[model samples]
Target: MSFRLTTRGLTIAAIFLTVVVVGIGVALAATSTPQFCGTCKSHVPYIDEYKKSAHRDVNCEQCHSKPGPFFFLTAKLEALQQPIAQITGDYEKPILGYVLNQSCRRCHNNDLLFHPVSKNGIRVQHRHLIEAGFLCMRCHSTQAHGDAVPPGSRTYPSMDQCLICHNNQFKDPQGQVATSRCDLCHTKPNYGAVPLTHKQNDWATRHGAVGILSTCSACHVKKGACSDCHKGILMPHPAAWISEHGVIVGKRGGNKACDQCHDTKEYCKTCHQVKMPHPAGFVDSHPAVTAQKGSDTCFNCHVVANCQACHDLHAAGDPRAHKLLGGANSSLQSTPTPISSPIAGGG
Candidate 1:
C-alpha cells in the first residue's frame, strides 16, 4: 500500500531539479546586467551614456530596483513589461521612469547632508530639504549619469526647479524664509569655474544691462568684483568722459545704452544747467551758431522749455522764442558747422 521510488526515478528527479535551479539562476543573473537591458533599442543610448557616467561600476538594478528582496523580485517582474511595451510600440518616447529616493539614500546616507561651507554671505545646507522629505533626484536629475538622457531631452535639473523652492517666498520648518540666493547652495565661482554665461561673448559689457547681477553674485563674490578690473568704475568710460559724452551719444542717434547706467536727462542737468555738453565758450558761440544753423541744434540737448525759459519767451499760448532762431524747419536749410573737437569723441 506504500509508494516507493526506484534508483532510476530518484536520479531523474534530482537531475531535473538541478537543471531548473541552474536555469533560473542564469536568467536572474542575465537580466540584472546592463547588457541585457540595452537589448531594447530604446535603452541602447542610455546604456552607452551610462558607461561614461560616475556610476559606471554600479549595476543598473542597484539604483533602479526597489529595496528589499521581495520588492526586488517584484521590480524584476514589472520590468518584463518594458521590452514587451517596446515591441508593441506602446512605450512612451523619451522613456520615463522615476528613481525612488530610498535607492539614492542607500548610498548617499544623510550624514554629510548638512556640511556648512560658506563664502561671502552665503551658506550651503541641505539638511532642511532632506528633513522636508525632498528626493535627492529632485535637485540632482543627472548627478551620476551626467547627460545620459534620451535624444533631445535634458537630463540635468533646471534652474527653474531650484528657484521654485529656493525662492524668496517659501519658509522652512524653522520659520525661516527660503531664498533664491545662489551662494546658499553653491561655492564661489573660481578662475576657470565661472558659469558658461559669463564666458560668452560681450558678457562683460552686457551683463549689467541684462539685470542678472544678483544671480552672478550667487557664485561670484561680487563685492568689488567689477571695480577690481574697472579701477573703481563699474562702467567703462575715460577720465574726460563727462565733457565728451554728448558727441558720442549724438553719433549713436539715441541714448538707449546711456539709460543703462544714467538717467540721461537728469544726469546732464547736474553739470550742464541750461546748456549740456556745451563747453565754457559754447554759451557765447551757441547763439551765433543757432542764428546761423538754427535752434534745432540746441534741441539736441536742450528741451524746448530750456530755450523758451532761458530767453524769457515762454508765453502761455505761443513759443515765440523759436521764431527768433527760425522755425523748426530752419535747421534743414542752415548748414551744420564741423567742429574740430567733439564732446566725447563719439562713444
Candidate 2:
C-alpha cells in the first residue's frame, strides 16, 4: 500500500509541473501579441516613437499589474484594467521632471529649459523636487490622458510665488516698502497704470525698447554726487518725482535714468557746473545762510518743501510765507531773508 501511494504522488507532481510551465508560456504569448484582447496593452501603439523616447521599453503591465493567483482572480483584475489600458493608448512618457523607472534622475539635464539664474553671473541653486515631496506633476504634465501635450501649455509662475518665503524681500523690517517713485530711473515710461492708481489722466507707462524691466536696486542707489547741484541734500523736481520707484519710473530728459547731477531748471550741475558758487544764479536761496557752515541752494533745509521756498508760484488765500530765498542773488549776505520752505506734515 505504501509503495502504491508514493508512485501515485510522483505522477501527480509531474502533471502539475507541466501545467505550470504551460501557463507561464501562455502568459508570455499573451503579453507579446499585438492583438491580445484580455491583458494590459500588449500592442504598445506608436512603438517606433516610444523606441526613441527616454522611457523606451517601459512595459504597460509593469505600471498596471498586481501579483495574485493566476486563474479567476487574475482574470478579474485584468477586466478591471481594460479601460485603463485603452485610455492610455499611444501615449508618450507621462511622468516628466522626475526619476526614471530605474530610479535615476530625469531632470539632471544639460539643456536649460527654465533654469533660474541670478541677474548677475550667479548660478541659482535649485530646490530638490524629490526631497521636497513634490512630484514632477507639480510643474509638468503627464501622457496618461491621451496623446502627449506640448510643454508650453503651462504658463510660467509670476514673481508673486517668490513672496511666499521671501515675504519681506520687497519691504523693510517694518513691512512697508520705502517708496515707489516711477519716474526715478525712468525719464518717461509706462504712464498707463498711473490713471488706475490715481484719479488723474496719466501718461504713466514708460515701456522701454522691448524687454526692459525695472528692478528695486536700479534707481534707489544713493547717487550722492549731487554736491555741485546744491551744497546740501539732493532734491528732485516734484513734477518729475516717481512715487513707486519701479522700472516704469520716468526720467526728465526722455531717458530711463534719473538726473543724478542736475535739476530741471538747470543742466546737471555736477557735470556742467565747472565754477564753484555757480555762474550767477543757478540756484538762489533765501535768508542768506551762505555765511553759515553749510548752505548753497534752496536745498539747505528746504528739500521737504520742494520749489515752494523759492517762489510761492501760487497765490492761495492764506497767510502764505511762501517766498523766494534771496532778493535776486544780490547783496550775498544781509539780515537773512528770514524765509523758510513750506511744511511737510502740516508743519
Candidate 3:
C-alpha cells in the first residue's frame, strides 16, 4: 500500500504527458486557419466568398466562435460534426447556421446600442427590435455578401432592409410611416430602371393589383408623374366615381386608366363578356343612334343572330330589318321581341 514511483520514473511520466498536451495544442492551432476550412469541397465556395467579403481581413474564428472555454469547445465540437454530416448529405446549404450578433456586438458596443440618432429626425433606432428578440441576421443577412453571392462580386445590401420600415404598409405606434420618397434616401435619383421587383414581364398590367401604392408614391408624386404619360386618365379616381367616371371616360374617348393597368383584350373581355361599351338604359337611345349611324354600328359588337333573336326575325337576308329599330309595335311578327337588360359585368 505504500508503493511509490522513483523520481526518475515520475520524470519520464511527466515528459510523456507534456508531449501529448503539445500535440493537442498544435492540432487545434492548425485547424483554426481559414485555409483549413477551405480544405472541404463544400466549404471552398464559402471561403472564396468570404475572401472577397467586407470581413475578409478579420479572423474567421472571431465571428464564428464563442468567447469562454466551455462554449468555444462546444462550438468546435459542433464544427467537428459538420464534415461527417456533409459526407452523409445532411448539412444545410448557404452556410446560414451561425448567428453572429454577439460577435458583432463585441466590437460595435457603445451608447448607440440604447440611443441611436438619425440626421433628419427620422427614427433609425433598432433597440425595440433587439428588446423584442430579433437577431441581426433578420435585417443584415447579406451585409458581408449577398445570399446568392457570385464569385468576385462586391458585397451588396438588400433593399428589403430599408423597405421594412420605410414602406407605407408599415407604421409606427403613432400610425405614421417613414417617408418613402427617393430624395429622402438618395442624393441623385436613378429613375431609369425601376425596382427589381417591378421588372416582371407583366408588371405594367398587374402593378395596380399586386404593387404597393406607397412604393409608387416614393418616386411618383402622383400629380403629373402619373397623368404626364397617361394624358387623359384620372387615377385613384375622385369621390362619387361610380356615378361620374362615365363622363370622364367619354370625354377622353377611352379609359386610359384601363389601358394603363390592363391588357384590354384579356382583362376587359373577361369582365365585359355580356356587354359592350354602352351603359344601362342604352337600349332606349340605341334606336335613334343606330338609325343615324346605320346597321354597321350594331354590327361593331353584335352578330346577326343577336339582332335576329331580339327582333324575332324569320328572314335572314332582309336588309329592311333596320326599320324595326326600338321595337316598333308589330304584332304581325310570329315571336315577340325580347327586352334588353343591362349586362351584369361591371367591376
Ranking by TM-score: 3, 1, 2
lDDT of 1 by residue, 1-347 (tens): 98588999899999999999999778877998988998888887778878888788888888888778877788889887888988888877776557888887777676656665454433546676677777766666675456665334445444444554665667777789777665456555542445656677888666765434434443445587765654344443565664566666776566654555556655443333334435689756876766654455455444555565666645556666546755553322122222121332111
Q: After superposition, how far is residue 218 of candidate 1 from its true place, in Å?
A: 11
Q: Count the backbone clashes (under 3 Å) in each candidate.
A: 4, 33, 0
What are the per-residue Cα lDDT tens digits for candidate 2 across 1-347?
34555888999999999999999778655663323532335334334444455545454343333332453346445545655756877434442222232122223442432354442222232342233344333333332222333354432322212222222235534565423443321344454432222243341322211212233122334555332333332333233322333222232233224433224223322111233334566455333333332223334223424545434545365434433334423232323221222322210
Candidate 3's residue-wise lDDT over 218-317, tens digit each? Answer: 5565678766766656555555664575577678777554566555545443324433457688767766665555544344345555766855554456
**TM per model?**
0.46, 0.27, 0.46
In order, what lDDT does every prediction score?
0.62, 0.37, 0.59
Off by over 4 Å in 2: 1-5, 25-49, 62-127, 140-347
Q: How far is 55's C-alpha from truth in model 2 (Å)? A: 1.6
Query: In the order shown, what is each candidate's alpha-carbon RMSD?
Result: 18.1, 23.1, 17.1
Weakest 10 consecutive residues of candidate 2 by summed lDDT: 203-212
Model 1: residues with Cα > 4 Å off, grouped in runs: 1-19, 114-124, 148-171, 174-182, 189-347
Error of 1 at 333 (Å): 66
